[model samples]
Structures are given as C-alpha cells and as structure tokens.
Target: MRLPCIEIIGCIAAIVTVLKLVTLDTFVFGDVQETFILFLNVHFLAALMVVFALAISAYKYLRLGIELMPIEKYVFRILISLAAFTGIWALSTEIIRYFNYQELTSAKSVSDIENAKQLA
Candidate 1:
C-alpha cells in the first residue's frame, strides 16, 4: 500500500530536526572531528530520506494516479521545500566551518615553522 504524502513529509521533517539537534550537540560540546562524523552521518541520512520520500510520492501520483487531500497537498509542498532548504543550509554551514578550521590550523603550523627556523 502507498503511504500518504503528508506522512512521508512529516517523517522527513522529523528526521531533519533530529539531525540538526545532533549537530547542535557537537557544536555546543566542543567534540573532536571523529565525534563530528556522527553529525555528518545524520545529515546524509536525512537528505537521503527526503529524496526517497519525494521519489515515492512522485511515483505514486504519476503512475498510480493517486491524489492528495487539499491540506496534505499544501503541507506536503511546504514540508518538502523546507526540508530541502534546511538540508542545504546545514551542509553549507558545516563545509564553511570545516574550511575555516583548516585555514586556522594551517596558518598556525606555518607560523610555528617560521618561529622554529628563527630559533635554530
């Protein structure tokens, strides 16, 4: 049996929220990069679930000719859009933070090398 679009969308939104919370936890606790892998995994899973839901919804509507109720139609649209937007936002934030962290560490290493050269 095919699932309703709203249910699928709700599941996606809930997953995304949970993933965001996990990432927030890492950010707040000063966790190591290894621990941050959990956050990345959560993000990946959330994105995957959203994509899967969209595909299922499309197949059911297009192939099976199933229709959603008025409220479910609008809410599904909003939830899917929000899920895509927030997923992109979260991923980009993580990428920017990673690059910034890399830049800072590299600069510090370069400065340390120069200092050692002067001391030798």
Candidate 2:
C-alpha cells in the first residue's frame, strides 16, 4: 500500500511533535543538561530506526525482483554505509562520555573524602 504524500508529511510532523514533547523541559522544573541528553538519545534512536527501515525496504525490493538503476543502487549503498558509520561514531562518543562521567564522579568523591578527613 502506497501512502499519499500528505499523509507521509503528516506522519513525519507527528513524529517530530512527539520527539519535541518527549524532550521538552523548563528551567524552572527541569535540568537542562538531562533534557539535552534525552534529546540526543531520542535523536539517535530515530536515526537508527530510519537506517533499519531503509535496510528493510532495500531487502524487500531485492526479494521482490524490483531492480534499481545503477546510480540509484550506488546512492542506496552510500546512504547505508554512511548511516552505519554514523551509528558507530555516535555509539563510541556516548561510550566515551559515560567513562568520562564515571571518572569525574569518582574523582569528586575522593576529593570529598579528603576534605572530610581534614575537617575531622
């Protein structure tokens, strides 16, 4: 079943709205830092979904014997490759951030202990 262009656009808009709602925060009642992190996570998940959908569509086309032109095939391959690379890059960045955060908190706690010892 083919979706009309307007319906597709509406669906995209609705997705964006939901994303906005999920990430919404106010300075009076929320931590901006946490909200930003949540936004990044949401964005990454959306990207992953898009990549998965593209892969599935490509697979379906191939299985159904629907042939793409040479240029189309090249573009599809390039997009898939880029998406995979981006996903890897994002994962690595998040991993590094997690380790850094752990290190920072550990260092802070050690310093706090030292300060407490000095106070005693």
Runs with alpha carbons beyond 4 Å of true place in candidate 1: 1-67
Candidate 2 residue pairs in backbone clash:
none
lDDT of 2 by residue, 42-71 (tens): 444655665465465445445544454443
Write out the backbone clash pairs for model 1: none
Estimate the overall C-alpha local distance difference test score of candidate 1: 0.55
For model 1, residues 1-120, the per-residue Cα lDDT tens digits are 546676666556655664664465325324333334534654445555655565455444444433655544454455456556655765765675566556666888999999999999
lDDT of each: 0.55, 0.50
TM-score per candidate, chains pooled? 0.52, 0.51
